[model samples]
Target: MSTAMAPEPVDNGGDARTRRSIARAVLANPTMVTFGALAVIILAFSALAPGLFTQGSNFVQLAQNVAILTVVSVGTTFVIITAGVDLSIPSGIVLGQVFAVQALKLLPLGEGTTAFDATANQTTALSVLVAVTAALLGGLIIGLINGVVVAYLRVPPLLATLGTLGAGLGVALILQDGVNSATYALDPVGNGALIAGIPNLIPIALVVVIAGFVLLHLSVFGRHTYAIGSNPEAARRVGINVERHLLKVYVLGGVASGLAGFLSLSYFSTTSIGGFSTANLQAITAVALGGTSLFGGVGSIIGTLIGVWIPAVLKNGFIITGVQPYWQDVAVGFVLIAAVWFDQLRRRSRDRG
Candidate 1:
């Protein structure tokens, strides 16, 4: 009887049924879920303060406020998809601004002097170009450092980037001390236009986001990146150039950071060294919270865009609603943790099967 019983514990239908259930759940409309959340937030805001929520001025302000963070978050989505983190973004942004300002100070400030006064600086576009270039270069250099440290030195991304975070902060401080600079005034000439009605920076951000989406979703290189992140050893076994591709991804992230910094300079008209550490962390959290698996290879630009904006929207909404500013931070922290926890649960369930 025992031998007969042991002969076969044959195919049970249980596993197949469980798999079907999971497949069905996964196939449900995710877009509706995202949109629903956005709607709830909008409705909540509008109900609380109809005028603030509906005003055109408020809408424009929100757009301008989110632009920098949205751009940075877009770049970070690429890195996190590869199961990596970039902690140096804040520093990179600060350094770019500093470098850009200093470059402007050096270029023909006056006939005999080495620095430009407020009047001279206010009228020139050259300084803006120089500043933007410096920002881009600074970001590229930081990204390369990140790649070299992670890919070659075998440093963990978290630890390596943390080191860069500190180093970058130090560099920013040095630049700040060296310059003894004051605020840069925004140039009013052609303020209402770009090369046309659309600002150059807006077009630049759109192009970056669109091109990044295309590269990540539609290109063979994107597939290879996902393959590498999903399983590095397997990717290499299939002859994917893992190291080179990773380096490129890191550099691209840096370039994105640099561009974000440039936009920020335009937005603020002044560089503040003290108030951006949180910005970098928030961008990372936004990417992670947007349903992008921290384990890698499962996220989208559209999701990241949603993730980035939700927090910005929430903060802006709170300000409009007279919620204590500190509460916004607490709320964001909770949202980030909750999202990560949910993601973990999802991953575990998938693994169990």
Candidate 2:
């Protein structure tokens, strides 16, 4: 009789333990949700807007729309991984465009007469190099200021970058006299495709994403970045140069933003001085949505690449499905909030695990 009574096992925490294990795994690698979410979103949109969203040309157009964003987001991935933010992305982009245009203006040219003339609506090897270099250098300068202020002067990254954003935009506006510049020379970089159906921008973005993956996931530099972000004091104790590393991270972010601007100009064949106003926010959203913690210490460039498509898909899908375009922003806002909330849940899982 006693044996029969003992047959009923005592209540245990086995289920709870299983849950904690899963939560911990999710915490360790958070993008599972984003991957699932991306799939669900795509399926739902395809079902809801079959003809427009499912067409071949629309997919190509969508890729083109997000190409520059992919480049910007990869850089943002690095900064956010270190528990830092860069609000000056728009500034870097605009300034890069302005600098590229200025570089073009400085080049000697024949109007519509030579194959390699800026004035002839064509770009030469030298002009392309000068333009790209000037744009990249412009970004580096902005990044330097951001790094110095945050790392050395000890300003908060958010505040430091915000200040840089305002100041840099002012400088760009002043330089361009509030007007956008135009050029037909760099169109190939934007529109040309080595593959018959693929745009050049897609491959450029692919290269950057691959390079970023190597930098942030495989290299020693990434480990240090995670260490600093996870625990700066601990990182310092372990002999990491936190300040210098932060500076480098910010510089990389700046350069990426500048490159985005250059790409934007190439694609559009002009600069929108007032364009990209929300680019920094959009980029940060893509980074965060990709499961890179705003609180820092974890990230994936591949995840970010997936994240970049969410806003784009939502915008295109909503419009195609007869939903109001403004709902795009609302949908993205909710998704972002959910992402951050999930991040908090992940932290809790870590604590429990």
Judging by lDDT against the true structure, name the best candidate: 2
Q: What lDDT tens digits, residue by residue, belong to model 1 across residues 1-353? A: 67775676553678987788666675332323444566688789989999977687676556556667777888788888888888888877777667766766677766654323445245556666776788788778888888888877878888887888788778878877844344353333212345454444555566777887899999997898788778989999989888888888888777778777666765566676766777778888778757777788777777777777677778888988998767777877887787777677667667753
Q: Which candidate is the best by TM-score?
A: 2
- lDDT per residue as tens, model 2, 1-353: 78785676553678998788777676567687887788898899999988888999998989889999999999999999989999999999988888888887777776534222353245677777777887887788899999999988999999999999999899899989988877877877777787899998988898999999999989999989998888999999988899999999999999998898888877888877788988899999999999999988988998899889999998999989989988989998999999889888878866753
TM-score, predicted candidate 2 vs. hidden true structure? 0.90
Measured on C-alpha atoms, candidate 1 has an lDDT of 0.72
* Model 2 spans with C-alpha error above 4 angstroms: 1-28, 111-121
What's every prediction's RMSD, in angstroms? 8.2, 7.0
Backbone clash pairs for candidate 1 read none
Model 2, residue 150: displacement in angstroms?
A: 0.7
